[model samples]
Structures are given as C-alpha cells and as structure tokens.
Target: MNEDRRGLLAATAAAALAAVAGPAKAQESETPAGPPPGTPEGNPGDFDFLTGEWRIHHRWRSGPQSAEWLEFDGEATVVGILGGICSVEELRIPARNLFGMGLRLLDQERNVWQDHWVNKNSGVVAAPGEYGGFTNGVGTWSSIYDQDGVTMISQGIWDEITPTSTRWRQRISADNGATWQETWIMHWRRA
Candidate 1:
C-alpha cells in the first residue's frame, strides 16, 4: 500500500510541474526573439563602412551664433555588435567635454535601419529612432524629437562615404520638415 502511495505522489508531482511549465514553454516556442521566419533581411553590409575606429572632426552650432560651425577634433570607436544585427558607436570630444553614443540596427522585416542616439549632456536616449538605408551609396535617416513640448524633425544624411572616410550631417526642422537647419556635421577618417 505504501509503495502505491509513493508512486501516486511522484506521478502527481510530475503532473503539477508539467502543468506549471507547459504554458511558458509553449509561449516561447510560439514567438522568437530574432527576425521572424521568412523575414527578408535589409541590405546586408549597408553599414559595413562604419565598423571601425575613426578620427572624427565635429562641427556643431547653437545659441546666438547658431549658423556657425564650431569645429572640434574627437575620437570614435565603432563596433559590430549584436551578431551584426546592429552596430554601436562611442564618441568622445575632450575639448568640448562631450560624449555620445549611437546604436544602429537593421530590421529585417521592415527592411530599414534604425539609428538611436544619446549624449552625456541630456542623458536621455530620448531621440526618436531614425530609420532609413543606403541608396546609391548615400544614406539618410530621420526621426522626430521633442524639445520643450515642441515637435522637431531630425534628419541625418551620410555623404561622400568611402573606404576610409565619410561625411555626415544632422539637421533639425521645427516646421515639420518644411525647412531644415544644419545643426551638426562630422568628418570621419579611419584611425
């Protein structure tokens, strides 16, 4: 009798464990973390030119002399992260006492790249993600960012991209892109 009771208890415990774990296992199997099955990938190697260390010359303007470009020299490190699904850039400008980071990811389903930017000044990864891809060797990405309850469009363009150097610019439009003003530009060379 005791042997039968022990067997029944073991069976019941096993059933209970399976019941608790069954839904979680099914949920995981139903959805995946990466690209979905049959998801067409975006342009492979579109950002390959950016996957290296670089000496960066930055041009930025704000305030009373908003139209002027105040240039500074900086260093940047770019790495192919997330198994090539994304790349990250770390930038430092000692003269300006500034640091920034950019994370660029390719969405297979959307067939576009999303660029996320953040800086030490605001400490907010608050920039709306810019989404675009290279066309005819030129890349453009834009997103809306908020400032003091005002909506702004941030547009970025990559021009003169080459094996060792590239020129990129950032512009902001307060009037829904009807007009754009260049706010930042960077000239990057292989370091």
Candidate 2:
C-alpha cells in the first residue's frame, strides 16, 4: 500500500532471506580458541563462518502469495557476539527504503538458534524469532507467525554455502508445513 508498509514487508523478507545464509565474511582474524565462557555444549561457532562485510543479491515475490518476482541488491554486515554463540546481521536495501538487523542466539542444551529481525524505521522487532539449527550443512528455521490475525508458518533456510558464495531462501506455508510458497531468495558473496 504505502511506502512505509511496503518497506516493512520488504524488510521482513530481506531479514528472512538473510537469515538463511550470511554473506561470506573476509578471512579476517582467527577465532579465540575454544568456546566462550558459559558456552553451551552445541556448536557455539555455528555462525562463525559468516562474520564480515558481504554483498547481497536479493530476489523475492511481491507478496507472500504473489507469483510475481522482484529483484534488488543489498549489503550486509555480520558480526559474532558472545564468542560465536550469538550473531547480529545488519541489512540495507535502499531501493525499497528498507533497513533492519537480525539478532541470533543459540541454545546450548537444545542446540537450536533463535533468530530475530528488527526494523530500523519502526524500531520494532519484525516478527517472532524462528527457532531451528543446521544439520548436514543445511540450516532451517521455522516459526508460526500471526500477521494481521492470519496464522502462517515462516521458514528460512541456508543452502549451498561455500568459500565465496551461498544461497538463502524464505518461504511461508499457510497450512501448517504442507505447502510452502517461496517469498525471498538471496545470494551472498564476499565483499
């Protein structure tokens, strides 16, 4: 509808896609040694692979149920906090006047991560955090969200990560997890 609403929706999708896989960080520095103090037994360094500036290639549908595709570019910076147990990603998409950040925290006992997105314009959390983890090199996070009173399942995934690039996608299912419609796709490259 209006620009702010449109930007908010776009920011949500961008954050979702960005959560799947962060852009490849620079060689940068080396990690401190073992896990940080109070670190959980799970992989504390789950997000270590993505910590630096990255160039983002973004694609998504006009709406959660729309089939039309839109393309744009964005940039992101990923930083590891609490010694890799937590991470924060800042996203920028000026074409749509969107800016936001994603904060991710890991659960040591359960080994799942809770990823959250926050919009800068509204200074509010985009939605409830998605909880999940990576298995066999693929990560999938899913959560049930209520948008305007409509219940929907939101899923974000990181697929095909490599030294220089990776793929990420976001999908929503209206009926549990039965059928999913891809809402966002992102390709990240080292910047």
Candidate 3:
C-alpha cells in the first residue's frame, strides 16, 4: 500500500508539470514578431536621393515684382524614422529666413502619402494635404494659408530625383485658385 501511494503521488506531480509547461511550449512555437504577411520591406534606394544636405535658390514673379526674380538659400535633410513608417524633412531658408519641418508619412495599408507642414516663425500649420501614389518617381503637394493678411497658396513638386539631388518648385497663388502666381522657384542640390 505504501509503494502504491508513493507511485500515485509521483503521477500527480507529473500531471501538474505537464499542465503548466504545455501552454508555454505552445507559445514559444508561435510565430515571432516580423513584417506582416504580404508587406514588403522598405528600400533604402527609394529615399537615397534625399540623403544629403541641400542648398536652394529661389526665384519668383508677382505684381510690381512680376517677372522679377528673388533668390534665397534653403537647406534640406531627410531622415527615416519610426520603424520606417515615414521620412521627416527639415528645411531652413534664409530668404523668408524661416525654418520649417515637414513630415511625409507613408501609409503602407493604403499605399498613399500624407504630408504635413508647419511654419516655425508663426508656429501655424496649414491644412494637411494628401497626394496620390507616386508615379514615375514624382509627387506634388499644395496648401493655402493667410500670412499677415496676405492670402498665399503654396505649391511644390518633386521631380527627377536621384540619391544625390532633387529638383523642387514652390509657387504661390494670391488670387485664390482662379488666378495663380509663382512666388518661389527652388532647385535643391546635394551639398
């Protein structure tokens, strides 16, 4: 009888160990953290052209200064952060002599890009804008804002970019959307 009781107690202990270890073993076999199924990894080549610092020259034509040119220097830096969800660009221009930061969030679910911009001087941000998927490696964004009682529409396009340089244009429309004016033209070269 004593031997039989000892055997039964050992059996009970073994059963308890099995019950506790089963779930842990199953969890360990489960899939580890990784990119979601069907989600491709981000390519460094896609953002290579924006890797370096840039110097910008701006020109514009409007009103009495119509057809006239204004020049300024702008510096740009692009960085990939937040698990590759977006790339943030910080630009400084000595012309308006303002510093601004913009964020380009890449939505993997919708495959679209959303842009947000804020003026550092006045700490005001215009309405956020969304652009469709990139085509032929080019994209455009525009926004309207009232600055010191002057209504200004700002438009920009990124064209012909490589890992080293990108061509960008910024234009302003004063007369709403009916009539447009080009206020700033900027070409960014890697520095």
With a 3 Å backbone cut-off (N, CA, C), the pairs that clash in candidate 3 are 49-162, 49-163
Top candidate (lDDT):
2
**Candidate 3 clash total?**
2
lDDT of candidate 1 over 1-191, digit per residue (tens): 14453344335334433432457766467432332233233575777788777899988885522666688899877765445666666678999898876767677677877665667686444322667777678887766667889898777888899899999998888887788888889999998
Candidate 2 lDDT over 1-191, as tens digits, reads 24454355446545554544444442123211222222223368888777677889899899766889999999877776666777777788888888888777776666767676778877654433667677778878777767887788777888898877888899988876788889999999978
Give the alpha-carbon lDDT of every model: 0.68, 0.70, 0.55
List, in order, the clash count of every candidate structure: 0, 0, 2
lDDT of 2: 0.70
Once fitted onto the true fold, the runs of candidate 2 whose alpha carbons sit more than 4 angstroms away are: 1-42, 125-128, 146-151
After aligning candidate 2 to the native by TM-score, how far in Å is the CA of 102 from where it should be?
A: 0.7
lDDT tens per residue, model 3, 1-191: 14453344335334433432356666466423322222322332344456445776666554534777766677766654545555556688766767875655555655544465556775443333533334468655555567779886666667877766677765566776577655666677777
Q: How well does candidate 2 match the true structure in TM-score terms?
A: 0.73
**Residue pairs in candidate 1 whose N, alpha carbon or C atoms collide under 3 angstroms:** none
Q: By TM-score, rank the candidates, best first.
A: 2, 1, 3
